[model samples]
Target: MPTIKEIAEATGRGKSTVMRAVKELGLRESGHANPDGARGALIIDAEGASMLADFLTKNVEAKQAAGEGETESSNQPHIDVEAIVSVYRERIDDLKAQIDNLNAQLAIKDNQIKELTCALDNAQDAAKEAQTETRRAHDQVVLMASAGVWERLTGFKGLLGPGSDMDSQ
Candidate 1:
């Protein structure tokens, strides 16, 4: 509990206003005696103080609605909305540019992938051709081995058969 004077000091209102609020709101005063067996002074509790605060806030808002609550802050300056919007637009443009750059990089990587795939296909075709040539060379070696041992021992030619290279020449 606090006296109306103390409440006025804490709430930044006059003591007369506090008393008027107590009267208007029908707030209760302290009734309990002190431990020294003395009666307490006229005071309102936290609940009554809270009611007074609400009552004051409503009155101020009502006055403001009636065009009478103009304060120093409201008289100062308005916010720069165009400047803020311009800053946001610049940020959006920067983000769009970054997205364009990333898209270009993605396209380059996609081209590289396509080129690598084409190179791999060409390498595989060359490897298959090399394998075919190696197989043909192996068959020639086998045919030469199958020529008669006598022809090899005597250093003779044209003795393998009609299909031999010497006969063809």
Candidate 2:
């Protein structure tokens, strides 16, 4: 298999642009990943080679045929399968590098999301527990007041005066 950069160089186009074209052409990496985790290139048969050649020819001609302001030299030369494929191999390497980078980023984001979710759950649980504690404390204070502890502390006054026990009345 060819690297996309090599393919682009041979085709007289930018590397990224050629890479996109190859991807759009439905070319997938073989399952073999390099140490960097790029899909390795596959060995193409005659039919695949011919197809690539035809694609290059049509691509070059299409651009030239558009009758835009391109110079004569701007049009690509005859397509050489061997050279193009050579460049394509390098492009495949670059693509693998990109894939590795994206995978690493995704892993980091996944970890971060997991941590944040855990923290959120902990915070929610803590809030609920705190609310329960507050409710329990309020109940204890109401019980103490209903039992008349406040009046007993003051040792009694006239029944109808300030701080008197209405319950007794």
Candidate 3:
């Protein structure tokens, strides 16, 4: 983290100027007591420092370009091709990295979906097997009852026998 004073010194500007720029840029800052106990200093991170540097560079370049154009009596503004190319290259690289990250995340989600689909298929197979087993057990119970197995096992001559009231009716 760099303090406001350090940023001002590095940019060769006043503290108030740096402070105003920082505030206008919406840079993040934290307050900490200075070494000399002069209240608190606003500390900015590397990102904020870089932003300030870029701002100062652009401001200086604009002023210089304006002065040059005015002195030369030329209507065309000065264009720095190299600086523009460098900035574009940085942006392209940043976008490519983001694309790679998104692709990786998409692949992970696709794998998860495949695994879930397989699990659902297995669960469906298991449910079909359970239903078949239940049907088979029901058939076995019906056969046993028709063959008088219940009477042999429990020794109870029920009405479902050969000469029962149901047969007469």
Candidate 4:
């Protein structure tokens, strides 16, 4: 049993508001009038008061949870879209830079390949000239041997005219 003034002060509500709420609660048949019927105070049993307090606490908690859930759901799509766009932009920039680098490397490799091909052609020409010079020198060596200015190590010689030993053989 508490006075209206005590309930109002404890709950931070006005006395009239407390009295109204008490009357509303009386609909549950939980409140009672005083024995003498003089300025009757709201009387609630201990179990009934506990039940009412529990119900009020649960109701407030439910409302708060519902509000938080609505806010989170509303913002979820916006957050996901922003994150996806940001990652896509970053990847596109990275790929563009990589392509630019590859183009530069390709140009360098093309120039190097051209240079190597030209050098290889020049080397082949030089080798052909060297082989011609070597064959001319060998012909001179054989002429010197036939003229008796040089001696053949194997003593095998062939004449270079119509009477050549190779022709007869």
The global C-alpha lDDT for each of the candidates, from Candidate 1 onward, is 0.62, 0.59, 0.66, 0.54
Query: How many clashes would you count in candidate 4?
Result: 0
Please write out the lDDT profile of model 1 over residues 75-166, one tens digit for every residue.
42232334334434545676698899999999999999999999999999999999999998888678768878876765446545566656
After superposition, candidate 3 runs with Cα above 4 Å error: 1-19, 29-85, 142-169
My TM-score estimates for the predictions, one after another, are: 0.44, 0.44, 0.45, 0.42
Point out the worst 10-residue segment of candidate 3 by lDDT. Answer: 28-37
On lDDT, the candidate that comes out on top is 3
Candidate 1 wrongly placed segments (more than 4 Å):
1-78, 146-165
RMSD of each: 21.3, 13.0, 9.7, 28.8
* Top candidate when judged by TM-score against the true structure: 3
**Over the stretch 1-169, how does candidate 3's per-residue lDDT look in tens digits?**
5677766666656788777788778774332212233665676655556676577657757777778746654543344444434444555676688899999999999999999999999999999999999998887568556766665566434534577554454
Q: Write the per-residue lDDT of candidate 4 for residues 28-66, one digit (tens) a residue.
A: 454432222476655443333333333334444665577
Clashing pairs in 3: none
Ranking 1 against 4 by TM-score, winner: 1
Off by over 4 Å in 2: 1-56, 59-78, 149-151, 154-169
- Could you give me the TM-score of model 3 versus the true structure? 0.45
lDDT of 2 by residue, 1-169 (tens): 4445445555666656654555555544532211222564333333343345457667777877895685666344555656756545656676788899999999999999999999999999999999999998887566555656656565433323475464454
Per-residue error at 154 for model 1, in Å? 9.4
